[model samples]
Target: MPPADDIVYLDHLASTPLDRAVLEAMLPWLSATGAGNPHSGHRAGWRAADAVEAARAEVAALVGARPGEVVFTSGATEANNLALLGAVPEGWPVVVSAVEHPSVLEMLPELARRGHRTAVLPVDRDGRVDSADLAARLEAGPAFVSVMAANNEVGTIQPLDELAALCRACGALFHTDAVQALSTLKLDMRGQGIDLLSLSGHKLYGPQGIGALVLRDGLALRPAILGGGQQEGRRAGTLPVALCVGLGAACRLARQRRDGDAARLRLLRERLFGALSARLPGLRRNSPADGLPGCLNVTLPGLDAADLLLDLPDLALSTGSACAGGRGGPSHVLLAMGRTAEEAHGSLRFGLGRGTTEAEIDRAAERVAAAATSS
Candidate 1:
């Protein structure tokens, strides 16, 4: 790893550094004076509960959902688990895209074990879930469908509106893991026909360990974490006030800044892609043209991404999902997109974020070029 001060962090999909403003909002709750369990009824507890509810409203606003619909969880992983495992009833079918994050993909076995029939929806070469394939899957009468709003690996934005419509037509509840999409996409839970949605704080410059699942009004879910009947019995736990405050602050900022950030990041992403293409003529683009503004996945032909990244210590990049790291296998996303294992091994994912700059993009290009040529 590069020295902290010297590293060019291009792994925003893995996690983002907490925004200073978000931290400021969290600090009061993190202090000793802020100690209070939101589940309690005393004065301090009431104050904590108020803050948590306020944060819940903020998170709800980001997704255009009612405040009462938000159910806070540990993170998107937990949210995904809750949506997949809790929403679908026994003996009912559950379907998810092939390229879903591991949190969602890994639930198939458990869902199967719980007596729910699980199915995988195929994606196109650009990592998009084909609506036609989804339509066919819907014919099987899935009780619930979980598709991501945007992919974390290739950054491909799925057609959630269309997918949700198809699910609605089939009378199947739809859920989306919007953890990566919230940074650039505008989400309206009601307008999109999204029955459930999942998001994480750290993906968007908020504190880690804080996330929420937004359920459509009147939708019911079985409790995944049973405890004190918090969150109206949908989820049960002592809410983390500090993390909730940070997530709310981040969501508020995201609503205000996403459009401007998307425009700026798109140009920077193109700049980096142009720079890299000019340097390495044979590199293959993996991310689609209309994907996330700051995501650029590419295959450096004839080179292993792990080896390449090892040589460029100052440039923080990844071969695939952070969750899939150290698993000793090729990217399941690439394989799902029909790329060979060798091509998956040669792939690199560049995730620019709020802090990325043109100069850093150029320098990263130069470093990657040098490393690729030498290899």
Candidate 2:
């Protein structure tokens, strides 16, 4: 493997490196002096609780939600599980997009087993759900809908405002798995009509092992985990103070720098695509023009992406979501977007991030172009 500096990483969708500021904010909580549990009744406990609440407020501010509305969980997977399993009444109808992450897609079987009426809404070639399809589904009365704000693989941004509006018209609750959207997009939970939003710390340059579910004020869900009754019994567990602090710091930094970061990333992403297309004219862009700023997905027809990735050890890239990569299958997201199995296997996802630069993009583009032509 190449040294970290030698490798041009284009897999931010898998995970982002921890930010320096986020680490600084978490250092105190990771130290012995920061050992007090928030549930305890003492000076140390009070201080810990204060730190947690402050972090909570920071997270809330980034997404235009109240501090109390954010309920911390182990990560976005747990948050998704909680949002879907806990929010929907038993035997109630629930809907999700065909391109959702495995965390959300895997819920269908369990939901069906538990007697919930479950359905999947399809996406277009650009990986966008048709609001009319959702409107048709919502005609069944109030149902819980889980659509990601942006796709993890293609980085396609969904029409949140329109989808939320459709759901509202029929009294449906709209939930978005926003783990991949927070850093690149300005999210307004209430304004966007998002009833429940799931987020992960690692996806936004924070520490792993922490995520949150932002619930619309006054919305209630059944308890997913039962214990000492924490977070007003919405989620029950001892909060990891350091992780929470890291997530909070990340959210604060994202709020402060999101616009600038998005603009820069957009330029870098386009540069990479342009360079590759110039060299490999046969390259087909799988990512939409209006997708996430840092993401670019393309298919080099007749070449297998998995094999291409194996040859380019110095470049960090992916054939699909890291979570699903180990499962040895063509990407479900691409398949859902109407790609043939061959096209899906030929696709590669480039996820640029805060550290990506023009030089790195150029270098990566050359390397990829060379590899494709040779293959």
Candidate 3:
């Protein structure tokens, strides 16, 4: 690994550093928490419950949903499990996009095992699913459709509004994993006809171990955890006051800074690309033109991204999704987008966030270009 001070992080998609404001909001709840177990009947419990509900309202407002619709959970993985496994019926037909995060993709197998029919909606080379295909699939009237607001690996923003409208017309519920899009997109669930939305706080400068599944009013999901009756019996657990406060603060900040931050990130991304392109030959950009401004996925012909990352330890980057960790393999999203196996191996994902600076992008590009070419 390179020297610690020289390291530049380009993997915000995996996780973001906690915002100082968010930490400040959470400090009271974490330390001398006058708020006790939210489930209890005492005054302290009432205080805790109020804080949790306020946080829930903040999250709901961020996504344009009612406060009652948001059910807090451990993280997006659990939120996804609650959406797919908890909402879909035993023998219903479900349509899911091919390039979704593993949280949404992996749930299909369990749905299939439970006798629910599963259909994978394919994407074009740019990793976008045509609305015509979605309309045709909804003609069969599947139980629900799950598409992401933006892909985690390539940052391709899907046509979620059209897909949600199609599902609504067919009387099918629409679920979206908006964890990646929360920081970059203005997600109005009502306007988009989205019935459910999944979120993870760590994706947007909030705390880890906190997420939410937002369901439409009057819609009930089978709870993954069954114990004390909580969340109107839709989900049962004691909510963590500190993490909830952090997530809410982060959501508020995201809502406040989205557009300006996106423009800044886009400019920095272009600079990184330009700098690297000047030095590194045969660089192929896998990210689409309409992709999120913050994420840049590029492929360097003949250079294994894993090997390059190992060689350039000064930069914190990714070969694929962080869920793949250091195991080293082709990205499912890249393969779904029609990249060959070798192309996938050579691809690297660079995620930029609010903390990212022009200086870091320049340094990272210079170092990465030198390292990749030399390797």
Using lDDT as the measure, which candidate wins?
Answer: 2
lDDT tens per residue, model 3, 185-257: 8999998899999999999899999999998987767888999888899888788889998899999999999
Q: Write the per-residue lDDT of candidate 1 for residues 256-315, one digit (tens) a residue.
A: 999999999899999999999999999999999899998999999889999888899899
Clashing pairs in 2: none
Clashes in model 1: which pairs? none
Q: Rank the candidates by lDDT, best first.
A: 2, 1, 3
Worst 10 residues of 3 by lDDT: 323-332
- Model 1 TM-score (2 dp): 0.98
Ranked by TM-score, the better of candidates 1 and 3 is 1
Alpha-carbon local distance difference test for all models: 0.92, 0.93, 0.89
User: Weakest 10 consecutive residues, lDDT, candidate 2?
Assistant: 83-92
TM-score ranking, best first: 2, 1, 3
Model 3 vs. true fold: TM: 0.97
The digit string of per-residue lDDT tens for model 2 on 111-213 reads 9999888999999999999999999998879898999999999999999999999988888899999999999899999888889999999999999999999
lDDT at position 37, candidate 1: 94
Report the Cα lDDT for candidate 1. Answer: 0.92
Model 3 local distance difference test score: 0.89
